[model samples]
Target: MSYFHKLIEIGKENAFVYEYMAVMDSENRKYYLERALELSRNTKIRPKDYKRCSYIAFQSFAWREYDIALEYANFAYDAKPTNDIINLLGCIYHHNEDYDKALSLFHEVNANYEGLNPYVLCNISSCYKKKNSNKMAIRYLEKALDVDKNNKLVYYSIGLIHAATGNKKLAIENFEKSLEIDNNYEEARNALNSIKE
Candidate 1:
């Protein structure tokens, strides 16, 4: 098949996988994402498409395959150092408990896309929290909240930072706020209960 034809096939597979993902059908999402990866990996196709590699990495992450996700994320980052790919690398590092690496990537991403993405700020906040930098974590979490006041992730992170700083009341307040936005947020619930206990 021609390169254009191969690209078309990859695009179709990505569309199908994304559609399934939108509906939270993890099994179907994985099936179509795997198909997408196979199509993208065909000998006739170029392997330099960072977007496809990023999608594959995301699929691996969704399936909890952290190592594979990290590999693909690194590939995507090397191919194109866009904010999205960089953020994915940061997430992979964070998931693997490589907080220092994750923190560096998050800072790089923040410098490139600062004030433009609450999610990136949230990721930075998480890395700071993991590193036991409670003040810095709170700073970034607040920045995330300023970007998106209704972001439950920011609230949760703020709760964690406050808890780590031994501010149980503030932690409970932020966790409650997180639960208000997402009642099923088990992390917030667990943190709140732990602090209470």
Candidate 2:
């Protein structure tokens, strides 16, 4: 860590240096990452390095810096609106509580791609859940089930929606399914206990 600090002192203007330092400094990850992003603007930065931009954006999102994530996500999106980038942007918007915008981007990925992606379906379901559209949320979760029946997350999400809607029986069923897939899933176990209580 001290080596990284010394490197930063010598190469204070290097975005990559700060970026790497961020990865090693969990306690100050957000600070170093934001500094790297700020310095990136002044540097050449590889003429639209979508991969790098995406990493910074994802890290920002992980740290709950939605605005910063959105900024870098847009940079990647402008370069090439791939499905992954679109999904990341949707996730950022979702975290920012812009459900409508998040839904639009998630739907765009569904429209442009063939076959169902469980992750995208789950994200769409999450946005719908946020909008209080429990029925729509269940519908997408069902689609996710079709994509991967063994996906414990899908069953867990279904359990959540059912629990919210006061369908205790269905909630128990789905939560059981989730636990059956992964008995160590603490969330499923906790949710199941809560429902039982």
Candidate 3:
């Protein structure tokens, strides 16, 4: 790939080329962005490279391009395979709606990499919820709460699941708690409103 090589040669001189890429503009931008990140990686080693790729993956995720997010996340994981990268890959898998794959990645992070962090547990809860294993989902969500009581997101998610399971009182309580923590939480507010009937 001469384009990548050219980028490698140009280095920081052209580093700014990847600042922004509109979603509809070009599919080829993925390669260029990956390469630029790789060029940054070459400075140190796989760790730096993986971080750069992960940053790109996050940007793609924010753009709702799960494919692109997965592509870059895979690169980062292959580069270092750390617990952080594994969990990030798990997040990409989650957003792509491959709950099983997301769960597996999260499990790897939990069992093989980091201890069960609040965020990892929250993601596990999500995967389980997607699979309709409400018991397991609630279990993990509760565990996440134990790990981080201040996480408004955890409360919001638990509210959603509880509402779905017809635990109206518990759902309302969780939604209220979520809103109490972060008053601007639109999803929780909406859920609270819908359930108030």
Compare the candidates by TM-score and give the number of the best one: 2
- Least well predicted 10-residue stretch by lDDT in candidate 3: 15-24
**C-alpha lDDT (0 to 100) for residue 71 of candidate 2:** 81
- Clash count of each predicted structure: 0, 0, 0
CA shift at 103, candidate 3, in angstroms?
0.4
lDDT sort, best first? 2, 3, 1
Which is the leading candidate under lDDT?
2
What lDDT does candidate 3 reach at residue 56?
70
lDDT by residue for model 2 (146-176), tens:
9899999999999999999999999999999
Q: List the residue pairs that clash in candidate 1.
A: none
How many clashing pairs does model 1 include?
0
Q: Model 3, clash count?
A: 0
Candidates in order have lDDT scores of 0.75, 0.87, 0.77
TM-score of each: 0.69, 0.85, 0.74
True-vs-predicted CA distance for residue 17, candidate 1, Å: 16
lDDT of 1 by residue, 1-197 (tens): 24434655576444334434423655565554555445444523234657767776787888786765776676677677788878888998998899999989888988897566888988888888788777887888788888889988888888877887788899999999999999999999998999999
